[model samples]
Target chain A: MSDPLQSWNDGPVKASIVEFVARVTNRGSSDHVPPAERIAVFDNDGTLWCEQPLQVQVFFALDRMKHLARKDPSLAQRQPFKAFLEHDLKTIASLGKRGAFEFAFMTHAGISEEGFDALAHAWLEEALHPKLGRLFKRCVFQPQIELMNYLRDNGFKTFIVSGGGIDLIRAVSEEAYSIPREQVIGSSLKTRVDTQNGILTLIKLSELGTFDDREVKVENIGLHIGRRPIFAFGNSDGDLAMMRYTLAGPGSRLALLLHHDDAAREFAYDRDFKLSPLSEALDKAASYGVRVVSMKRDWGKVFI
Target chain B: MSDPLQSWNDGPVKASIVEFVARVTNRGSSDHVPPAERIAVFDNDGTLWCEQPLQVQVFFALDRMKHLARKDPSLAQRQPFKAFLEHDLKTIASLGKRGAFEFAFMTHAGISEEGFDALAHAWLEEALHPKLGRLFKRCVFQPQIELMNYLRDNGFKTFIVSGGGIDLIRAVSEEAYSIPREQVIGSSLKTRVDTQNGILTLIKLSELGTFDDREVKVENIGLHIGRRPIFAFGNSDGDLAMMRYTLAGPGSRLALLLHHDDAAREFAYDRDFKLSPLSEALDKAASYGVRVVSMKRDWGKVFI
Candidate 1:
């Protein structure tokens, strides 16, 4: 009676998704792909939800830092901690992607995995997006949500391939994107199994184990998923390698990049932005045959 | 009508599994677990298949060494390679678990993930078990297959947590155990995304990453699955930590250790064995409430 992707406009982006799914799912078609190889990966931040002003996980980390600083006041004087305490966004941004991961590891480590998960869950449940004025999970793009559901309904296993903490995204992925914890892959810190107070626990370590960005995304996908994805979606240059890797596989392939150009509904900054930049990928998108979905033109609505 | 686990005798081992599943799946029961939390982990080498004489993977590696040696004849003179080339089982056994892993890393690395997977698949398809005289993949235990299926039918997600190479086991896991590659976790080597002759490939590196044994199994389950398993099955001391970790969860749990005491059906060596030693875990099984299933007593048939 109603369109499943009601938020998506009648454009090439929607048309491409529909065409690809139909071609692959049609058993008699030459392009038909079996259900087992129908793996679709999506970038979490800009591609699925609002990522402007700051990343949602980075925002959560800032809040966590303040809470942690209360117990150990000297943390306020530390380089990265001081950056958060003073609300000096420039210094933190200048630290680059590696710095951002270090910030997350320092703030998120020294606790059991269950304890960290609970903390992240509580924050996501209560924390509101600054611009959206709703719970952060509520800021997800409605069209993308429909596409994920549509793909799953067609026998695809959807996985969130994010550059954020694996546990952080896993805490709320089930509620936000209908993705289970097991399917979410992201930047991870090494964890050690420890018995604290006679309770068996996996304690998060301060050292970074894997950074799920650029080339690392492809490597982790190979290690964890054991197969190349048929479909992939992302927003910036950080996702270029994954898109390339997905397209490199034999048979049918689809890769899309969501362009953040709708400033009225969602903040827009591409080439000039420090986080999730979209310059080189934008220039090479045409050559690579990666579809660039315009947020302003391709969608009837941004968020539900 | 016959019982689902017909290969397993009507005893405490099978009874415990049935009882746990019934209690967890029954909606009105106090121990009823939601479908999302019903995670079951099994060790790959011995718990689900024949691992005597040598771990199946070790056999696979010895075959791989011969193949590699054909390309480079100098490998026959190397220490570990000489052990294999000379057919000196004693030297290889004396090298211990760490040496065994090193041998695996050296033999398995340098190829693309797809390439390595293809090699393993070819080996498993052609190579027969030395003692059983059947394909190595066909050596899987029949009762465990039924248990995995029964648990899946009741909505539990079954995962293979092994100390073997992740890629090696993943090659044949789907057909042998009816488990997908994504649900399998094991010891992993570092893999780099490399562009070889314009074809993008994930090349396996010689360095080991996350040796999924002993305590590391618990840590990996937390990292990959992001939740505690309620059911665990293993055959060696290497799996003791995983069993303890599973039982430490809040609600109903079933942890079983398959004791290799049936020399008639399969080779039996526990306390005196170099690989998959059962000495420490066997002594502590009663204290931890872990049931040790006897192969000679509890299993009606070893393999299908």
Candidate 2:
């Protein structure tokens, strides 16, 4: 058969992934998990796609802020929006995830759910990564796509469990990762329903409901998926809990962490990327039996 | 082909359901929806299974309260637990859903997620309907099951969007409705994750999160499913928003509300049910084009 993971070089990381799928999928093997229970979750930003130079959603939110500021100049004077409008990544990073999430709530709320989805879809259609010179949707890692496809072909259900906005990830998830909207789990704001023009309408509220990160990632996985995934992949400290949670499930499990050291091909910023620092995960990955995949060494190419 | 809905008697409800499915699944038709977008959501409790005497989870919570009261007698002196242990359904009803949810948080919290699942799975195995003389898991309406199966066979993805606790419904959803755990959406409590004996552990918290009812059901469907469902089946006013939301989507749509008027075969209670009073939905179901499912008239059997 033709190679499924064409973008992946033959390496220990790829070998381990292949071996794990083979063992779990072999019906007569003791490690065999029923197809329904073969759950695998993945982190979106750094693991599945590029997140450097700010997460793609941050850029989307920044653009939304710019548009809103144009209509009401007062928005540009606000803290996060002000930082966003000035293109001051340092100030926004100083605000960290809290600042980004606050921006998400302010820029995302009060719009109809359908309206918000349309906005995201339109932004992704045109938005480009300044550094990569590629559309944000086109910036996904090619090897990860194949890995997900391979897992799915071997009877595993793949899900995106990320700290990014659920609505934002879902807009491009299906096309970018071939993952359905229902299989994507992410941070969310509470929304309310109302009737408009005799049509039922759901409007986003500024209330931050759940932030899927670290411990909350595991909690949300438990709540939304209701099954412990057998395999998990990520590239930051935010995904460490999920990685540990997946491996802790009874029976054979596998967890992998991505190391973005391929700055020549793609951006390489970790542990210092204030939004999603990754020091402990990289340090403790070996102790937890998590395989650390070096993008520079393991990937033959970055984006497809 | 044999009848997919044999339990559904010859009626307008059955005809409408079949016709809607046909139109949506017919590829060449204008009403046809792409299989990926063919979403269907059902309300649990009175709609999918019997909720008479009290919701099934309330009984489970009452049992938990009894067990806890045995160890701590002072718990029997408390309001909801006192009412529960004294077999005071009237007071419990007057205390209403607030009391039941409080009991859920207490009984469901502090335990490991897996531990609670075991408890629910164990309880469901032995618990019987007080009046129906059948296991709680077996008390589902056969017509609804057949209808869901029919929808799935016609390329629709079916999900349970209930006002009941998500964890409780998930325990029996697969066995009862053939729905997967990930497809079930319901009321939830926030959970926290920790490490126990080097194993990842998720503990449920007393804090209530999304109480999936009325408007929230629509919002959750938007968040989790990320696509508007073309079909929705529900019972009580708690589901009216979901029904309207489903029909509000463009193209062929259908929504049905269950009217539990089958006194001879099943308990008949509506506006008086208190916890899930079915007044406005029943009174105005027709104006929104929602069909009322009369269990006494349309159904051939109440349970499999």
Candidate 3:
């Protein structure tokens, strides 16, 4: 009978987020903010949903590689494709940045734009996290979803800036987080226009474009959003640039970082994780006056 | 005073365009078209505006090379930079495709995203084509602009499929052509996110992603628009793929190629010019049933 958002644990982090939204939205109150200045940004992966052991995009690539290998044995012998065909997560993970990128190109290449979106949507609806046993969409953080809506309801234009594929995020972001497709920022590949048989088609290229990570996120914010956001939230170092950018704006700002210290409810790896590393940035959070949120203390539950 | 559109010559090509619009927009008309099938695409560059000597993006790159050389003396000696600095348009033009691309990277690299947009906008407002003697925006084809609006009024979603930078097209596309930013497809560089002093910035990569030429244009249309267009207009072989894709789609379709045969009004070059080569495609247009419009016979005037 009660609202799930109201039942969320009353803690400093949640309280701070709600308080900021209330202040910005309340026109009769002193802290009222104008629509143009009401910008809020969020990091997607761990901040909005579970990103552990492997990123969602990596999983999608692996699945696609397997699908291709069934059709062509040659793919099983290729470099990253070989790792992907053999289900060798270690080799694929070891490929690090370059390997991951190569895997992305191989997995996504040759797919018609329409076909790719259909596959992505199908995967989101059916695929479950290996450990979570829940639909990838369901694994979204309840607190963050609540936070996004709360901000949006208060006149804030929320955006998701991630290192994931822009199209992949755009596929389900609007449904899950209520962020419009245009507002989602991420790395993207080049596309070409094709018209055959009175049909317009967009083809994906193997060429890599931008990787929306670290300082690039900051640069993308300035390029796409134009004005700086007054509020930001993230769970890792990749988000540090965005946090810094938000705080650098002219007026009052808020930056909050979720520290995954709770190993009991969720996976915890800060210093040694190859994907979504958060060590160096975590060390400097205090000096920047960024609110460091302890997952164990701040969140009442891991997932809705 | 008389309206130019009414008084201007209405040849078979222009008459065909007008006839199609009337049929699609008229509910009681025999050729009434459904809204879902009303899709139209236009090639940017010479088809929509003048692209001679070099594409505007290449010009931007050359300008950037000069700017970069001022700060880094070593750049003055580099292949593209050296050619750009010495005002040797001949040498730069002779570099062919690879050389042209190299010039693009050298010119676009290292500048901040905001810095690039500011530079592009400022140059566009002041610069004039060597032949047109009018501001670049003013040189847009008046007939084509009217055609786009006519198509939109008839339930068609008109789009600009370009070989230029997507961001650059998005900058002034609405004012110049009435095409929305989201509908402009073009070549692009990679992007990354960066944070500095607690501020987020999006940086455009020096690397190339997809070149929206040949087959890539068809692929991009499928990726972005999610539908096949029913009408397409182009000026070069770079747009052949798009025209092919459009003609391949179901139902009645129209594909037009604007041949720059009018030397006195507009520069006429196909096989002889390295930029926007159209010899092979032009030869095949007849077999493909594509209407090859002679600029000399198709219209009364060239520029608006």
- Please report the candidate that would top TM-score against the real structure: 1
- True-structure lDDT of candidate 3: 0.74
lDDT per residue, candidate 1, A38-141, as tens digits? 99999998888887777887888999999999999999999888987887878777877667766766788888888998898899989998767999988889
- Per-model TM-score, in order, reads 0.98, 0.97, 0.69
Query: Which should have the higher DockQ, number 1 or number 3?
Result: 1
| Tens digits of per-residue lDDT for model 3, B212-289 | 777877766654554577799998888898888887755567899988887788778887667677787799998886
Off by over 4 Å in 2: none
DockQ computed for model 1 against the true two-chain complex using alpha carbons: 0.78
Lowest-lDDT window of 10 residues in candidate 2 chain B? B96-105
lDDT of 2 at A70: 88
* Interface C-alpha root-mean-square deviation, candidates in order: 0.9, 1.1, 5.2
TM-score of 3: 0.69
- lDDT at residue A190 of model 1 (Cα atoms): 88
| B1-304 per-residue lDDT for model 2 (tens digits) | 8899999999898899989888988889999899999999999988898888888878898888888888899998888778888878888888766556666567777777788889999999999888888899998888888999998998889999998899898888888888999999999888888775667888888888778888889888988898999998998999999998888878999999989887899988898988889999999998989999898999998788
By TM-score, is 1 or 3 better? 1
